[model samples]
Target: MTARKIIHIDMDAFYASVEQRDNPQLWGKPVIVAWRGNRSVVCAASYEARKFGVRSAMPAVRAGHLCPNAIFLPPDFPRYRAVSRQVREIFQHDTDLIEPLSLDEAYLDVTENKTGLPTATQVARTIREQIRS
Candidate 1:
């Protein structure tokens, strides 16, 4: 296989996941990361909220209307950045060719991974497991 080995890691609804991770009460519930205002747009929405049509970049007012029960919270960039850095560090263990798309997503070129993983899938899975731990 001559194709380059690349892995795209995206933390689904990272802001919402962080909220859920930090606050047990938010787990298994609709979480919307946005301010409470018509001008505000949703930064991220949990799967629970997505089921109700909530999404990133959607108007907060619409998000509220779509998921009235959703827990709306303001964006916390500093906290998310810290978490992102930790995630990036995990990627560093495998490869240094990381192209960060956002706080939660990155493109990793693991063609010649430092960890000696035979396949990109294994590298991705290992990074995921590290994040979980």
Candidate 2:
């Protein structure tokens, strides 16, 4: 039997991060990705907003009260999907054994990687740099 080396990538607050990246003004400010309504749920919240206890699946109304000054924007799914595809492309540069969990998360089996990175951590680190670049 052979051991497997796998790396899990979860981009926390992905939607909120994208929002901040796309709009420079939102950077460093609390960001909550949700519509403004009692019934709407939070899709994502930035670390800034998380400081106020906001979280994914949380009620938008509650998140609003938690961080009143937080930038609230409905999710931009199309843009997120595009970025997801790009991220997948970066993974392919290292390995083909990718198991996508969502637009912001995935698992990559790099036991026999294309990059010959020698270690799973190195492969993962390079992948992270590629995604950020």
The alpha-carbon root-mean-square deviation between model 2 and the true structure, to one decimal in Å, is 0.8
For residues 12-63, write the lDDT of model 1, one tens digit per residue. 9998999999999888999999999979999999999999989899999999
Candidate 2 lDDT by residue in tens digits, 1-133: 7799999999999999889988999989999998888799999999999999999999999999889998899989999999899889999998899999999999999999998988999998898888777
Off by over 4 Å in 2: none
What TM-scores do the predictions have?
A: 0.95, 0.97
lDDT of candidate 1?
0.95
Most TM-score-accurate candidate? 2
How many clashes in each candidate?
A: 0, 0
